[model samples]
Target: MNVRTHILRRNNTGGIFHQRGVAALLLVLLVGISATVVTLGTMSYVRGSQKSQLTVHGQTQAEINAWSGAEALGQYLNGIEVETVTTAMDDIVFSRDNQTIASAQYKPDCSQTSRDLYCFDVNGISAGHNSNLEVVYQIPIIRDVSYTEISNPIVIKGDTEVTGGGMAYLSSDSIDGFAVDGNLTITNATKSIASGCATGNIHVNGGGVEDNGHLYSSNGDITLEGLNLVGADIWGGNINVLAGSGFHFKSIKAVKNLKVTNAGNFKSDFIHANAVSFALEGQLGETLVHSDIAFGNGKSHLDYLEAGGNLIFHQDDQSHVPEFTRNSKIAGKILLRTGEDGNTLSTHYNSTFKNIEQGRTATDPGVPEWPECNVDATPFDVNTLISQANYIFYIDESDKPMLKIQNVKRASDDKSIDATINLSSEGGMNTAYLHNKPFFQCEWDSKSCITSKSNSTDGWVFEGVTHFPPGVILFAGKGNPNQRNLAPMNFTLASKSEKVGPLLNTILVTGDITLGRGGGRKEIHAPYFSSPDAVCDGDFYPANLCDKSSGSWQFEGKWDGDRVERNYPVANTSIMVNHTMTSEGWSLEGSVIVGDTFKTDSNLTNVHGVVVIGLNSDEGGMKITQGGIVVDFMDLDSNFLNIPTGNTQVTDESTLGIPTAMWARYY
Candidate 1:
């Protein structure tokens, strides 16, 4: 505004104005730089978000496709005929919409040694993701392990070689494998194998020779010692390990005369012998045997020991017994297999025990009772079979009874009761297992009865005239054995009786057999039978014993063995029985049980087959004094015990436990 008029003054003002102008320009440049930085940062953020989403989606798709590849491989394997030789992949591809999505390499797992075992290992890839899966398809053979009754001894000798107990499971409760009633001698050096069947046992009678196996007489004091025993088990005759030797890994069990010689370093889970003798062995892992340690002289480690006869700490001569070393102690508990509270172990030494428990005689198979009867049993004569041999009855629980009887006298309360058999009076079956066809009675001409494809039909075996798929049997009783205060009901034959299983043909009892008991305070007497012969005419109180055209029964006691087909009886199985039992000359074939409290002064009576006694009772016990002898168990062909034919690993599903695409990885 002042123009050239104040030239001199303007010159001075011009310098200050120029400085302000320069400052304004610098501010504009800074604003432009800030705008450019904001725009670039926003663009970079958007681009990063897009890339993250794409990567996530792509990886997820890759995993899903990889699983798809696995499923495809599974289908192929399922369809192909399996061979022992593994099948390798030859550029096989899986696609969707004609676009390749997955590829897999499958290698079958087959055992040439085992004719019918197969499996598959699949390696799959999709996009960049990969997965590996294993699938089994077949089962193994039954002969991999078996135990037959052998007369000759089985001897194995070799340092490196092994007489495997055969390939089977190994555990405390049950094992699968074979057992020999005769002697099994494993001397030389090879380690013996243990039986692995749960329902099966391997017993040696001639005496287990651990001759590098064992050293004992045949049928004499049994000494369970397989030549080179690693985990094998032997249950022949009376067991005695008194050869002044030591055991490393062992479970010595015997029916009688069990003596351990403390001469070797012992290590194992148990020494469950009838006459178990050990001293000063603690549970360092499992108790190990030491040669220096003597019987009853020191501390001994044991899980459990149940003696049928007298539990002796030393042999008769006391030569095999050792003196206590280190400390006189019993590391674990020792159980006497009897219900007598006052029964004591004959220990003749001054020692200390941690725990010494008592085993009460009782049955613990909590099988439920029945509900009703469907059998149409007509009144008939109770005699006629007195001329035949003894009678055997297989009693089981049932929901539907096919035979009905009325007005029968009970053994315990001496009362008459009407009941139906094969019928349950309370609930349904514990297991809803229905056989495809009868085990016997081959439906006229059904080709599927003899042989089956496991899935197509129910496998069955029927011998003699006795039918397979027999209806479950029910005994009439009003007592619950589980409750000690509650009394049991009885269905007895005479004064002394027992129940023998497996009506080889058809067991016919010609006496009053009472069944179907509700609830009462009475003892249930379950008995096994003996060999019956023809009763003399004078023995028959009623003349027309066989001809019972009338309702009243004519015979006092008579059971016939005529309905049997093949003689297979189930043994050592948990059965339902009452508290009190009394019988002499009873030969129960199939299993073993011991320790009675009843003091019955009897004569020399020999017992064969499976004789189970002194179990599931806290009441008065029994003691069979004098001439009563308990023998070994031998029959196996006809029994309720079923051993799996194929390998234990196989299942009905056929895929083992592996999964296809529908499976989640278990890390």
Candidate 2:
């Protein structure tokens, strides 16, 4: 009976259980779906984070690569030859992987003004896993280019037109071989081709009319309109420029005539010529015309005519030769070859004939013989030669004879005699440099010598030579000046101090010549000399004057010359020796004494600008001749003068408002 009732209930129970099972299955499915969703979300987040990290790393690497590329470019730029453009890649490198990151556009046109000199700009596109990067590199443009690398032979040729702006650098050790095949038109106002050579030539092409420095020629020629030449050896083969132009050269050796048809400015020495036969129509400043400069007038304007050598007088168009009849200060001999015409001396200006063969001074009115002066004459003592010295001159007589003199006095303080010299046919030497020996033998002439002490019994005193006034002398010969053996104007001996240079050859004195000095001061003896007629034969060698000699005289006075050499053997140069005074703050004229204060006047005013040079002076005080002319101003020694307060007292008490533990106290 129970089994039958249970069967009925089982059917009902099974229905209910099946329903519950279905609900449970639905719940299980829902939970599984939620779990899967969470897992997918987490996986997506991890993958995104991983991609982002890779992207950041790649970007950083790209930036680093870009910086490296920039450095590499800089190195390449640095390695480029100073005057020559890089033909091929010297050492241009790029990272292989980062190469696609950027690209650069080079501007080969020198006339174009492009902002390609800056850094490379990077444009990044995608920031995710698969990112695309773009890098833009800039090309370098040179401005105010400097040559800092080793140089090579660089020839800038052709009708290479620089229309806009371009710059070229030829640094030391670098030579620029500029060849203008065609008309090289450089219209760029700012364009410059600065050539700096260590030991090479900048052979420019002929017919290359430039608007600036060194216009045209295989050999250097000043054909430019407005160019400043700073070359050591300026061989003006054919220098043709506009009138009233500026031609500034350091050392000019012109083989041909320098004709300034219009007004021109020549501010340098014109040397090494048998005769300067040219029609000068310009303003000449410090015109040092060497040899017999045959000058004629053809609408020519001469500023200053300085004859350092013998001057020849000849008519340009069969006219009477104009001669200088006044007190002409001629350095060398004078020859007037009228050329079968009448000899008439005329002076455009008041010129002085120092060593005159036949000059107009009322006494010597006509021309003298070949040996007008003495030759093979007796050697005069230094003291005798210095006194009554009206003029000093040297003549060339040696036939290929090199005049060589040793142990001779080049300068002297006492002036008791005058000197005249003529070179001998066998060739003579007149060297003023004293090696280990004295410059001259100083024998006190009883009557001429001054006593050093107050007692009349004191022996005759040998006055040490003082400073010599600055003056330029020119020497001339009947024939070729270069062919004749001539001596340098001045020479000096080596000094004892290491700071002093070797025996000085040339010294430019910028002061006045005085006899005596102040009280208690010995004659500032610095031996020097002058010989007018020491020979009358052939020729001799003349050493360079004003060269930097070891034991040379100190240039304490203001120096003014056409040019000033500041290096050994005249390597470096300065245009002028800057000096100043009260009225002449920075004048080209003025007598400057050595060891002078070069300060302000007693009126509390600044004096002239004087340059003081010393070989060795531990005390920093120079001994000046007592009565020597010196220019000083109040402000000159202001830097060294210290005004002490009268109330100030020295104390060493630690607590008494004074510094204690002071060492190295003298008193």
lDDT against the true structure, per candidate, is: 0.26, 0.24
lDDT of 2 by residue, 70-158 (tens): 32333233212322222233223343434333222222342121332222222222222122222222222211111111111212212
Residue 620's lDDT in candidate 2: 18
What is the C-alpha lDDT profile of model 1 across 447-541, one tens digit per residue?
A: 21222211112111111111222211222222221111121223232221112133221222211122111121112111222122111111111
Give the winner by lDDT: 1
Q: Estimate each model's TM-score.
A: 0.21, 0.21
Cα shift from native, residue 234, model 2 (Å) = 3.2
True-structure RMSD for candidate 2:
37.6
